[model samples]
Target: MTAEPAVVAPVLPAALRERIVAEFPKYPEKRAVLLSALHFVQDTFEGWIPQAVVPEVAALLGLKPIDVWEVIHFYAMFNSEPVGRCHLRVCTNLSCCLRGARGIMRRLEETLAVRPGEVTPDGNFSVGEVECLGSCGTAPVIQVNNERYREGLSEDDLPGLLDELRTRLAEQDAAKDEE
Candidate 1:
C-alpha cells in the first residue's frame, strides 16, 4: 500500500502571527477569532486565502481544518483562489437588477474581456456578481477590491471606471516600486 504524502503548514510571518494572536483576546474563545484571523491572512495574500494556510489557522484557533474551510467557504468575501489585483464585483440583487445591473455587467464583460469570476489576461481585473451591496437606494453598484463602492452606476459609466481603476492601480504599483 502506498502512503499519502504529508502536508506541511505554511509559516505565518511574525508580524502577521502577532496580529492574528492579538485578536484572541477580543473573542470569548479561540475559535471565535477565526474570522478575524482569516481576514488578516487574506489581506496579506491580496484577497485570496491559501489552502495551505487552512490547517495553520485551525491549529491557531484550536479547531479542525474543516472548521476553517467551512468559514472560508461560507463567506463570499473570502476567496480560496487567486483573483486579479482589482476584483470588481457588481451587485445583481433585485434593486441592482431593476437599475440595469445586467447592462452594467455586460459592459464590464465587453470592456474587460472577462466575465464574472474571471480575470483579465493582463491580470489587472477580475469580475464577479455579488448578491447585494446593501445600498438599495443606489441600486446598481459595484465594489472595487471589496473596499470601495461605486454606486448609482449606469452602463455608460463602466468604461471610464475601468480606465480610472487601472490608472490608479498602476500609480500605486509605481509608488510601491519607488519605495
Candidate 2:
C-alpha cells in the first residue's frame, strides 16, 4: 500500500525553490535530484533542513515527499534541526583520526562544552563528527560551513577560531541590534 503524501507547505523563499526546481532536469533521475535539493533548502535556511519544505520540491517535480525525506535522513551533511550560524563538521575518518583528529575533537568538546551534534547556547557554533571529508592529506581537518581549513590543528586552534567566529557573530549581532 502507498503512504499518504505529507502536506508540507514550503517555508523556502520562492526564489530559492524556483532556482532549485530549475536544476532538476539536468539530473539523471528524480532520486539523484534530492541531494542537491536538500542542499538548496539548507542554504536557503541558513543551516538546517526542514522536512516540511520538501513538499514544495515534491510538488514541483511530482515526486513523493518521502523520497526527499529519505535522502535528507541518509546524508549527515543535511541537518534536520536548526544549527549554529556556522556549522563545524570535523572529519573523524581514518586519516584525520590517525593524525590528531581525536585530540582536536576532545578539545572542541571541552572548549565548546557541548558534545557532538549539539549547538552552543549562543547559537554561534555547532560541531559534529563526520566521516572522511576526502581531505585525508589534511588529517584532522574541519569543514566550517562548507569552507575547509586544514593543516596541523593544535589543541589551541579550537578556542582561538571559536573566539574569532564569535566576535564576528557579535559584531553582526550588534549591527542587527542597531537596526
Q: Give each model's whole-structure lDDT.
A: 0.86, 0.78
Cα lDDT over the full model 2:
0.78
Worst 10 residues of 2 by lDDT: 146-155
TM-score of model 1 relative to the true fold?
0.90
> What's the number of clashes in each of the models?
0, 1
Query: In model 2, which regions exceed 4 Å deviation?
Result: 1-10, 28-31
In angstroms, the error of model 2 at 23 is 1.2
Looking at model 2, the pairs that clash are 96-140
The residue-by-residue lDDT of candidate 2 on 3-90, one tens digit each, is 9987655587888877777886898765566677778878888788766777777766668888777777887888888888888788
Q: Which candidate number would show the highest lDDT if scored against the true structure?
A: 1
Tens digits of lDDT, candidate 1, 53-127? 888888888999999998999999899888888888989989999989999988888888897777788788898
